[model samples]
Target chain A: MSRKLLETEGPKWVAQGIITAEQQQRLTALYPEEGRVVGLLPLLGSLLVGLSALSLIAANWQGLPELVRLLLLLGSMGGAYAAGEYFLRRGANDSLGIGLVGLGLILFGAGIVLTSQMYQLIGYDVTGLLAWAAAGAALTFLYQSRFLFALTVCIGGIVQGYSTGQLSGFSYFTAALTVGGLGWYWWRRPDAVLGGVLASGILWQAGLLISFLHAKITWFFIPAMLVYAAGDWQPDRPAGRALQAPPLVAAFLFTFGLALYGETDTYAGLLRPPLLAYLSALLAVLALSAAGKRARGRLGSLTDWLLLLPGFYLPSGLALAVATLVVLYAYSGAVLWRAQQEHNPDRITLGITLFILTTMAAYFKLTWAFMDKSLFFLCGGALLLGLSWYLRRAAARALPPKSE
Target chain B: MATPLPLARRHRLVLLAVAVQALFIIGVAAAGYATTAWGRTITLRTAPVDPRDLLYGDYVRLHYTISQLPRRLWRETNREARPNEPVYVVLQPAHGAYEALGVYASKPAIEPRQAVLRGWITNSWRHGLRIRYGLERYYVPEGEGRKLEKRPVLLVKVSIAPWGQARITAVNALAK
Candidate 1:
């Protein structure tokens, strides 16, 4: 309500000269909701198409014939252009719709050109990947879809860090930049999809960074703490109030806690980052949840379970592995719970990443151990089954009970 | 609410621009590649000099093959060699492609029977090619001068042509 008022009120204020031209531009560009039908159409359409394209690209990894892949990538852009033309001719060129479709085509085309050119040069080297990704991001800025823009840039940063053979430093930097920069940008305007994109990138990037950069755990907490502090003041809009802040706060605090427990550091100040991060995130999410519990009379969102990740970590090797399994289970549980609550794709993705990471970690652990490999396998298998059962129970419990 | 921008058109334009640029760059690269691989090239043998880079590592900056003035061009000019003087050289028979001819001094005021080659010589005791201008030295890899074996190895002559064009021709390798 207040958020809606604030958003509608903002443009008027700017028109009245209350806001500077640049501020007005930035704010308006941050969240464009015009082109009602067309705007809505492409965003929905692109969601499916984009996902398919991404899956296909990922699936062909390592096995893709370079020449054929290049041609297909380029051809995809051409198809997108034709689609855009059709939309334009069909009178879907409303400002918002045009912007959305334009953005989609731009992304599709840029993705093709860059993928081919970059693959040609470095065979998917870090520099080329980052460059192409940055180019796509630049397109995002032009199209004013920070959600996609932020995602591309974050992925680019991760690829760059991966290229450097270290996931911690570069990934952290890119994640922080993408998350914090876009987070702050969208926070002012508070678009749901854009905010979700920012949060997702931060979660994955931070998770990956922590997994790699265990040497300094405290540094991970800085942004988490900042995000928590920022999420304190709830925005008036539905997009900002209910969706964006809560999950971000939960994920950050959870990751920070995990960083504190799992990462080994001798420095006395090492734990402060995670401590501060977790506390702030906890405060923000709890504050939001309390508001809903008090006023809305609804159960707390399962996103709060992100906090369990940090709390479950243990120092003992066997205990730590068990706790990791627990955290992964909790992560999946929270995603499923959120999916049931909101029926959003974001939740689905969170669930998927949790499953993938869990499977990868278990595989790595099982394959690397020397003696007692059988025990490792047995225990890991037991944990997987146990977690699967727990998740199934959690999902079943989340459902409304059937009448006896 | 305003109408959305037609994304497809904008995307096509963007792709077109990128593709054009890529094609242009590749074309230039191909041309250079062809010239290096198949085209006739005269080698200028030279010795290596030292150069340093702050960020990247140091390298031995190599000198050229035709490092000195041709004796025939020098004697025919009838002008005594002077120190710190610029010279100009011209190719008599134009090669199939652009080629670097050795350096000489100024052209004669009166038309001579033969081309007045103005090759300059330093007043140094060794009577060798002087390092008058080093920024323009063209270098090729060592032992790649099989084509230049028939032609006289011209000295590293620096010339100021009639149109103020400066060229160094007849490059020879410095004796190690």
Candidate 2:
């Protein structure tokens, strides 16, 4: 609890005979007031100074002699690293230390770019920027900082983006580094936030790779689901679920889009990959995911895979749309059913939201063309109100009575 | 999670890592100098782009005359040229600037006067292929890029290192 809460409530507890005033005084002493606001003033001041310095150097960058510019780059980079080490050794402000170190890492990248630009150098390969990502990975390992791990993931994305978009070639090595370096780190550490960040970073690279190849977009799911399967193998439940969330969201959105647009044969045709190859790859991932779920005794979550059903393979018509909607309802219903069984209030709320969304989509899709405008609104409103009431009542009955 | 390294060991590693990064940046600079000092220089012609389109920040985007070449210059006849495939272009001096003599999937032996510059095929079509040599961007001194944009045509001096690195050394307007 916060010191303010304790200060306001401690005397009342003593007055109520829950504890003596002496005990209250001791408890109050347990939570020392933080000097965070005081600490922030100097940080803000330093940030302003740093930004001013940066602007001045940037404004005069081209005017400066080459040697001076190079010296400034290296000198400032070294200074940041030294300051980071000093603060880290001091141990009073670890985040600030790590922040400075991260700054050094960023400056290293800027240095590489600036140095190349100085002599009008053009590198056909990614070697220069790859070093930046490698350094980031190394720092993350050395410091064991989530901040650095996330930073490395971002660096990997930026490098891959440049390699593909500008250089016109996919840097498979950079992709491998992110998956092998940062992925291994996340696998060992299993942080929920980092897991989410890592998964999204990997997905971003995978998306770029797919675009670079000009492959059918459906091929994207292969790498995306590979990420989801990796999450299944993670021993930490919360972190694993966090990692799985992005791929699941992507699949859900794709399936929802299919429901809305599957009536167009052209759209459905674009989604079809070479059937045998795609199915085999997807099935292999499914087997891996199933095995991991079984090992972790989380087989109930297998319902999440329902969204991956290849409804687009069906001939594009009302049939495909209806099939997709059925899958959505089944998946959301499974979520609700499982949430209620586990008495997880958060999951119940999510399930309710998904169910309502699916209902709205289904109602709009089936009725919008034929129904009168006023009647359509009237019916949608009434249906939503009735469905919400039923779902909330069901939720209330499933959850235990709250004591507070 | 792997246990964090001991503080002293971590410090040493950080020092090593930072030093390596610094050295890498220096190496890039050194390569920039090396390419110009110990490399063959060739002049290529650029069709002037719109002045507004030319100056982007401190760099001017150059469209070299060799940027697009007839597909017949593609030496590999067995397979279709793929986008983003790295190809070697042999250049021979014609008039004041080098013109593409041939495009090969692999580096081809060139006569003493001919130079091989590496580029990637950005797009390939029935009759022609568009290539990017990575020398398309010329970083200019502050406010200098705008002055080059107005020229109808310009000659860019590029140095191609023997080790397959290439860079733009200078750009000048074609003498009327």
Candidate 3:
């Protein structure tokens, strides 16, 4: 129904004879053919007005009494909400209504702060931030507004950070709340800004996951690999709840894992639990992804799937690591192939980005062994140029013909 | 699926939403009013570090002088107070002002002017118990807060409510 869906897939379906040209036209027309919206203007105006209003209070005009200041803060907050509701009731200019709600939310928080300052009130900022975030999130649920949800998530992270002592003392309950709340919210409304939920989940995971890994740093990669595998697993094709945001989470996790790997050059730590843990977890993820594909009978044959997942039961950790990386590479290659087959531009874009990240990480990581700076740069430059040309030509050849 | 509320029903919910937010603001004011109207006023020495928090706009991070309470200063108590738990501190007359006489894990029944106040047990060492009444941080105007930081000792006016919760009402800088 979106413009991107029509533009990218319409021609592909037409070429493949999936739908008649007339049926395509009718299907596309079913969506409202709205022009680009001017929603940003009202939102921008409201932000400017909100900032100036808060700034006016900040000036602390001596003549204004404390009671009057409190009244002004309350009056403006109530007025904004009332107006926002009235505008929504009209069922026109919804952006303006949303903007008003945002305004009211901001002012409401500012009121708590201003009153705190006015009376020199006591309490940690966490107390107020949590309250503000809760109120904002409630509004988001009430209205199903993604923007306000995004706003609340940002504040909620602050609450998490402060409560846990800059996340140094992040408690188990906090981690559970972050994962649980985001998971529930996404399940209820997957379409509402996935950005916030992903961010909160990652902040909680990375903060807690890496915190426990003092020396066993590479183990951090498993959670992300699990996320990617979760997304990559689907019976018919690569899809599921994992497909929504886990791939992106996984790719970044892969990048971080590589960065962590690159930080070390020791051979001693390679056989440890972190490594063994990572290898086993990586195999489990690979097996899960392969199992889904195997069930659907998409990956050619059972032997082929066996080739993709090699040495899963291997006694040595090193062999398992090698097999896991091979499986990872195969899965990414499958993602690219599937993206091309389905004409899923988003998947293709993500695949390409991950490839570039992995390649760059490898290049820098390998070059780190060079003793002399000049030698490192010389080898790195050559590697970059070679990989650049090779990747460019491969990409060009992989694209669909322009005739389509 | 959520059935759409009737128009009148929607209006009432919206009003309720606004009222809830309004009530939060009034709650803050109500606390302030209670302190000013019925609570006793006391002054304590204070110091400032950072002057601004980007999230909450302008405010100074205040560190009160009473933050460090010696463990020996604690009177005969029923039990040891845990770290970061709200405990009542009994303030007695000391050096033209008041200092903590004893820190209790729970609120202690007190005389009319015994001055029982609520404070978090920041820490307790063999030497002393570090207590921070939530009134430690005093919010002030932008550049103005920075000016207060220069003074070695700034007098902080605290209004303690009938219920023991304290609020910093004012900060007075000492001129050299």
For all candidates, state DockQ relative to the true structure. 0.02, 0.67, 0.33
lDDT per model, in order?
Answer: 0.47, 0.91, 0.62
lDDT of 1 by residue, A1-404 (tens): 24455577877887899888678667766665555687578779978998998887755543565445555555555455446446545654544444544454455435533443322211212333444444444445434454446556565555645643421124343454466555555665666565555555565555556645553454444444344334434353455443445445555445434433443333334434455656676566556555644454334443443543444323434455556556665665666666667655555556655664566565554454563778777867876777667655655565567777
Flag clash pairs in model 3: A231-A242, B69-B129, B70-B128, B71-B128
* Residue pairs in collision within model 2: none
- Badly placed stretches (over 4 Å) of model 3 are A1-55, A61-63, A124-127, A165-185, A195-251, A254-346, A371-375, A395-403, B1-8, B35-43, B46-63, B68-92, B100-155, B160-164, B170-176
lDDT of 2: 0.91
For model 3, how does the per-residue alpha-carbon lDDT over A1-404 read when each residue is reduced to its tens digit?
58669867998999999998888888887886564467667768988998897688657643368888889989988888888887888988787788889889988988887887677766533455456766776677677676766666565665566655432244444344444664445445554236435544544555555654444544544564444443334331322333325434544454335343523335335424544566677688668766755565554322223222323234534444444444545555666666667565676766666556555555555456555888877877786678667755655666766785
Q: Model 1, residue A215: what's the lDDT?
A: 38
Best by TM-score: 2
**Candidate 3, residues B36-98: lDDT per residue as tens digits?**
778788877654434343113355556665677778767656666556655678876566556
Tens digit per residue, CA lDDT, model 2, A295-404: 99899999999999988788999888888999999999999999999999999999999899889889988999999999999999999999999999999999999988
Regions of candidate 2 where Cα sits further than 4 Å from its true position = A7-26, B49-54, B68-86, B104-106, B121-130, B142-150
Tens digits of per-residue lDDT, candidate 1, B1-176, equal 22333667656655664464334334433333343344332333333333221012111233333335444434335655555444544333232112224445555443331222232334323344443333232322233333223333223333323332233323453332
Worst 10 residues of 2 chain B by lDDT: B47-56
Candidate 3 share of real interface contacts: 0.48
- DockQ sort, best first: 2, 3, 1
